[model samples]
Target: MYVLEILWIVLFRFAPLPRIWAVCLIAINLGALFFLDTTYGLVALLAALTGIAVMMVIYSRLGFVRLLGIGHVFWIPMLIWFAASLPDRQTDPALYWWVVVLIGFNTVSLVIDAADVVRYLRGERAPHYRWRAT
Candidate 1:
């Protein structure tokens, strides 16, 4: 199932038409809500997971100037939901702090992804920082 999810995401990434991919993404999210089927959720979860994996590969070679930021954008929300869902020994808070955390992370991720995209568009071979650790 995981492998299949990965294949689906890779296919989406390479899809020629942005509209097709967007439609597929929306359909999956809507199906998850309408049918209460976790399969669609699971697929989305897999996509987020793959984003991290792909980021790792890119970062290893190019260093993390932007990809990490983009990842945070997507990841923060998921992290917040997961955190808020946890049972506490004392009491459950009315406000979901986890959701806030997720939002923060997502925003950071978006910034980084955008930076990388811009750099790539400008044909940048190297980032501001040294690719290798000091």
Candidate 2:
């Protein structure tokens, strides 16, 4: 799948920080899936899967460019969802911290994605990886 391939690229093709980020995101989402609160976990996964879907579509149209991060736009709603539902999840310490860390990490990621998208808009149009479009 493109998502795994993206993870691989981030892990191997990119530098250390991107590798750590890819792993961290995986850890966070997997934790959500394993959480006792199935509803909370599923909702969180829903937002993430939607973002992956968007990224897949964009990657299909364009190669592995900076714009791929545009999929993370879905995180905007997820963040809002987290804000609205955070108080309830507080009862679950693990899940609560998961949400908190997710918020901080994703907030930073969104900023980076936004900058990459802006750069893509500004004509930095070359593909990041040359291994074939997908």
Candidate 3:
């Protein structure tokens, strides 16, 4: 999971292939959710929808900068939930390692996202591609 997440992040950050990376990540996440227990999957889906709605409202009112500021707040509870759901380390070593990898991925994402928010708050414009100099 860590490797996969890192690959996705790298693709998004430096590969200049945002749409492909986004689609691949979305597909992978959906596949994972599909394999989860029905109740948990449904709850996660709902939470995702709620987060999108909240982000949309924030973007509409405060614009992209503020939205990025608080957009990743959901990760805190998600990390906790993932930790709490982890299987016993001794009895299920593979599952334990997988959960740890997921935690690491989320931690990295949280740090990066927070740094982006801080940069925005400090008046740095978000980076983007340019076809030619203005």
Best by TM-score: 2
Q: Global lDDT for candidate 1?
A: 0.47
| Candidate 2, run of 10 with poorest lDDT | 125-134
**Per-prediction TM-score:** 0.39, 0.86, 0.55
Better of 1 and 2 by lDDT: 2
Error of 2 at 126 (Å): 1.1
lDDT of 3 by residue, 1-134 (tens): 32343234445544556456445434533443653654334544554555556655655455434334365466578668867786678975654565566566546656767887777678776433222223
Candidate 2's C-alpha runs over 4 A off are 88-90, 132-134
**Any runs in candidate 3 off by more than 4 Å, and if so which?**
1-25, 36-43, 61-66, 88-101, 125-134
Models ranked on TM-score: 2, 3, 1
Question: Candidate 2 lDDT, tens digit per residue, 1-134?
Answer: 77777776777787788778878876876676776455667777887888889888887778788898888888887888886777445466777778888788888889999999999999997878744434
Candidate 1 lowest-lDDT run of ten: 93-102
Could you report the Cα RMSD, in angstroms, for every candidate shown? 13.5, 2.5, 7.2
Name the best candidate (by lDDT): 2
Cα displacement (angstroms), candidate 3, residue 72, comes to 2.6
Off by over 4 Å in 1: 1-49, 64-91, 131-134
Displacement of residue 46 (Cα, Å) in model 3 is 3.6
lDDT score at residue 17, model 1, on the 0-100 scale: 69
* Candidate with better TM-score, 1 vs 3: 3
